[model samples]
Target: FADPSQAYDEQEASQEEERDGQYFEPVVPLPDLVDVSTGEENEQVLFSHRAKLYRYDKDLSQWKERGIGDLKILQHYETKSSNCAQTIGSLPI
Candidate 1:
């Protein structure tokens, strides 16, 4: 007879594996970037693998870069839910 407890463990393990692999699309690492100001909404992350520059003034956001240099990032987006403490712990301090 199959052990019920063992089967439960196996099922849990599979679920974990599936969840981990669900985010298959890799995000390009831009460790040097950061969001300088505090806002109710988090900064956005663009898919393009290039740095962007902009000027901000009380929600007056404008792109200053058109393939210009000094594309260092001032903010990076956090995709995971804010309620999930584990996800935030993984982010850079």
Candidate 2:
């Protein structure tokens, strides 16, 4: 005699499997970075990875690293001043 709409559909499928097991699934897997810049109050972003450099803090959201080498020599320094003005235009101007 215990039918009552199949016991309220098995108590709403056990409260939707306990709200899908209270989700939370980060077991490492984040670095594929390559943003480049943002900060200056835009709340940080700056990533690069591999050749190093990473920021994305944004009030501690994550991805901190920051600094090592070759973020295209830190986001292009005019290609090292255009290779030092082509080595001073072959020396002469």
The models' CA-based lDDT, in order, is: 0.46, 0.49
lDDT for 62 in candidate 1 is 50
Sequence-dependent TM-score of model 2: 0.21
Per-residue accuracy of model 2 over 1-93 as CA lDDT, tens digit each: 898999999999999999996978899989988987522222222342334446698898999865554321122333322111111212311
List pairs with backbone clashes in candidate 1.
Answer: 34-74, 34-75, 35-74, 35-75
Cα error, candidate 1, residue 87 (Å): 34
Model 1 / residue 28 / CA error / Å: 21
Say which candidate scores most in lDDT.
2
Per-candidate RMSD vs. true structure?
A: 18.6, 19.5
Q: Write the per-residue lDDT of candidate 1 for residues 1-93, one digit (tens) a residue.
A: 999999999999999998995755558855777767534256443322333334455565554532323221333366543321111122321
After aligning candidate 1 to the native by TM-score, how far in Å is the CA of 1 from where it should be? Answer: 0.7
